[model samples]
Target: MRPKDEGACSGDGMAGRIITVAQQKGGSGKTTLTANLAIALRRKGFTVAVLDTDPQGSLGRWFMERLQGVGEDGGLEFSTSSAWGASYEGEKLKRRFDVVLIDTPPKIESDLRPALRVADLVLVPVASSQVDLWATEGVLDLAAREKRPVMIVLNRTRPNTRLGAEVAAGAAALGVDVARAQLAHRVSYAESLGRGGAVAEGPAGPGRDEITALADEIMAQAGIEGAATIR
Candidate 1:
């Protein structure tokens, strides 16, 4: 039997662009990246929704905390689903929001395909270590198979370090698009996430700037247009 048609949005018109943040290894900061990116986009006046497909439920937990602490999500919507259920839930979300960010679980191989199929752009977060770089291969290959556009995001990077430079070069050598905006290793990223808030909520700093630049790059790559002025 043929595979069921998993609807994929072309990111045209008003359909929300679905961005799946996938990595084969854990601790690559996928959840952190998703949460922060959602906030950045929301600040740009895009209605955002985050679909957490990771079994760990980190994103869901953060959203709950945000609700408790802030009494509102600040225009961000949150949902949870199994990895396989991402396509269905993601498509539904795309209709109602300007951007849908899917956070996938670690080490999910074949199960990652459904999410990839629905993604207009797949963001693979590679930390500043060779181990993290090595772990990204599986995800890169899978996204390639699905013919999804991918951008490698260098997360938790340390500045002025040889290892950081090497990893950036190595990522470029992979022949995939690497994001120019790299997220530095920042304590604020974790502290804000723990509070169900993002760096965007904090005072202007490197963390906020990094996420904003990356979010802008992602919007361009996803072909999303007409972003409102950043508040």
Candidate 2:
């Protein structure tokens, strides 16, 4: 189904919301979150696509594994590229799809700049650790300079920990919006994605609730109105 914002034209006159998933730090579950969010949004009856601008191509590999039926129904229909020059195609995909999630490289200077320039919303996934939180500052700085609306999604957060709160506050201090719900450090999230399916498509295991909750918080922050067609 087309997104409700279909009439709104992008900078190139396309109709879609370009959400860039980025963070300067590695191993913070950037690709994992991007992949799952693609599925979550698609399951809600909105057409979704992913643009992997990372040199590592982790998101692209995940898509390949998914197509082989190694994982759950990602519900995303899209492609991956190593550079932003393909953005014309990316914009086309967005117009054809409801939402386009851009998975950017870990560095903010090179590959990420172009995508950020065209993004409607930027989702920076942060892990719960001093090193990760500290590392987030660089990316946040870049986003701030770009003047893009940045929202922090705390990934792999441990419950009842002062670190989580500290991270959230630190992000807010930077004037970045931090989603109230955070993704837990769960084996199910890893295992589900390993099997080529997002947590939403995996068995209703231990981490299912956490993934769904995270999805809900993201939708709220993105200004995605109305009830989602829960899968």
What do the candidate models score in CA lDDT, each in turn? 0.87, 0.74
- Estimate TM-scores for all models: 0.92, 0.85
lDDT of 2: 0.74
Show model 2 residue runs off by greater than 4 Å.
1-14, 70-75, 227-231
Residue by residue across 1-231, what tens digits does model 1's lDDT show?
A: 111112333344456789999998999999999999988887777778899999899999999998999777435789998889999999998876778999999956878999999999999999999999999888999999999999999999988999999999999999999999999999999999999899987898888888999988998898876556456
Candidate 2 residue lDDT tens string, 1-231: 235433343355547677888888889899899988887776676667788878888887778888888543334665767656535656777665667888888774766777776777888888988788888888777777788888888889888888877876776776778777678888877777876778877777546666677666766666664445655
lDDT of 2 at 63: 83
TM-score of 2: 0.85
lDDT of 2 at 201: 76
The candidate that achieves the highest lDDT relative to the unseen native structure = 1
Go through the candidates in order and give the C-alpha RMSD of each one to the true structure.
5.6, 3.8
